[model samples]
Target: MTHIRPTAAPATRLALAGAVALLAAACTSTDSGGAKGTSTEAKGAVPAVSAPPSIATAADKALPIDPYLLSYEQRDQLERADSVLVTRCMARFGIQYQAPPQIPGGNRPRSRTDRRYLEMTADSAQAYGYHGAEGDRPTPAPPPPQVSDATRLVLTGSAAANAKSGQGGQDYNGAKVPKGGCLGEAKEKLGANPSNNGGGDAQLARDIDAGARERSKTDDRVLGVFKSWSDCMRTKGYDYPDPVKVLDDPRWSSPAPTDVERGTAVADVACKQQANVVGVWFAVEAAYESQLIEQNTTALAQIRKENEDRLRAAAQALSS
Candidate 1:
């Protein structure tokens, strides 16, 4: 996502801060729906969710991550986090899993997790009165795999036949295929069935599932940051404060930007320059912190402790 620096007028600086505070607060609201449910009090009290350690320190040090070689526990932790996030998001947004609408990129059917996140996003849009006429939330999952059961069976049968005939797995056909057997044939079948080549059909599905898992984990982290930012910003005070008031501000766009874009923008404005440093820093920090708190149901302290312990163990291993 691309980050765009916000340009608010000098006169509206306080207004902007107030607006952000309102946003920070709404992010914390636990009520079922609209105006009555909205309150600033929810901002500081982060739900008791936890987060994994950051992939690397803020210093940009490369953490020792090998996609192909993650430890079982590490992978399990990621899967658990993914499941939790997908389930929560679907519930929050009220997304119907039976028939998810198509999204750009591809037509992958919505997964359970995708539906959940979409539901959450929909509710958020509705809460802000930005509901789409279609009334359907964005599909949280990637495009449904273009391949069908028929396609799979057909390909599998063909491959099996070819393997038996010695005609399968033979190189130099009109189509290009690597020289290998059953596993290789499986890869080829995936590629030919949907004509899906990118990650090699089944390979792609695994990759997407893995990606979803990783993203789920990050969502928790972002939520944790949100809670901390809300708490920190609450201390800064604003006149005529109301969490819903930000919704009234012209600049206050609900779903204020994609999380990543907002995070980058906040970091850019806060960490890169001294101009409007305090407010900018606060905004950026608040973006991450607000996300963490609002989305993360775990306690920040606990998340940090677990991550820190893991980091310590890794350091010990390196030393040993």
Candidate 2:
């Protein structure tokens, strides 16, 4: 098994598109679950949406993973060896590889059986050519853009929302309202808050506050996700191979591109092995974000505006 480095994906265009996507989605969803009685805040107006309580109290809400960490080091390593690093990475993430499973109980098969099993699996992979690991061999390029069927599977497969909804399909766990298009009924009927001044449900408020603090610590978690993916690849022998040294490696522009891409890629490889894990990760983040934004839309809006500028710069940097 050989390691392949991943190319850096261009960041600016990617960020710009994401920002625009969020903005566009916000404007269109009438049921964004904002102040229902009040007239929706005019988009250009100081967005009337209230900031979450956590954002105003000098508490930090954890940001999601940035996703642009890899620099094509993994892809280069695998490509040069004429092995399918992506497939191997996918295998680490849990895609079915034709290789024999580690059977316990010393169920050692006869040599003939083992060879027959290996040959069958190898033929299946060769026929499919996931992520073009086999395509690098002397074959005409299957298609331009060269995205593999596995990659596509990772993309269109269960999105991040499916697993987050608990008993009810609409909510992220009935803890907060769905921010995006998520909707479902609740499993447990929620109770009303008790009065304060030694009269209210102090425990409930404390629980909510604690969750806010935990969710705010997103940077480390996001980094861990990247490290986890990289480590998984390494375990499968895609050990961060340097793309620069690999002959004719594609010029990727960023580590993982962005949080969305990183999540999608993780889902692609991981979900194949562990379905709904990606959706769960996304749903947790989304639900936390909803709570945080409910208290601090102003700050988030400001960051979002700056994000547009940063994305433009990133795109320009990549283009240059």
- lDDT against the true structure, per candidate, is 0.29, 0.27
Please give each candidate's TM-score: 0.20, 0.21
**Which runs in model 1 stand beyond 4 Å of their true positions?**
1-66, 69-224, 236-320
RMSD of each: 19.3, 24.7
Q: Model 2, 191: alpha-carbon shift in Å? A: 38
**Global Cα lDDT for candidate 2:** 0.27
Could you say which candidate leads in TM-score?
A: 2
lDDT score of residue 252 within candidate 1: 36
Q: How far is candidate 2 from the true structure (C-alpha RMSD, Å)?
A: 24.7
Candidate 2 per-residue C-alpha lDDT over 1-320 given as tens digits, one digit per residue, 9 for 90 to 100: 12222222232222222222332232111211232321111222122222222211111222221111111222222122212222333344344433122111111112211211011122322332122122222212222233344333332232343343223212222333322111111001011112111111222222232343244223343234445545554554443322111112232233323433333333335312222222223334435534534544443343344334433433442343
Candidate 1 local lDDT, 59-166, one digit each (tens) = 221111112122334433333333333233323323222222222222111321121111112233333322222223222444433433322222222344334212
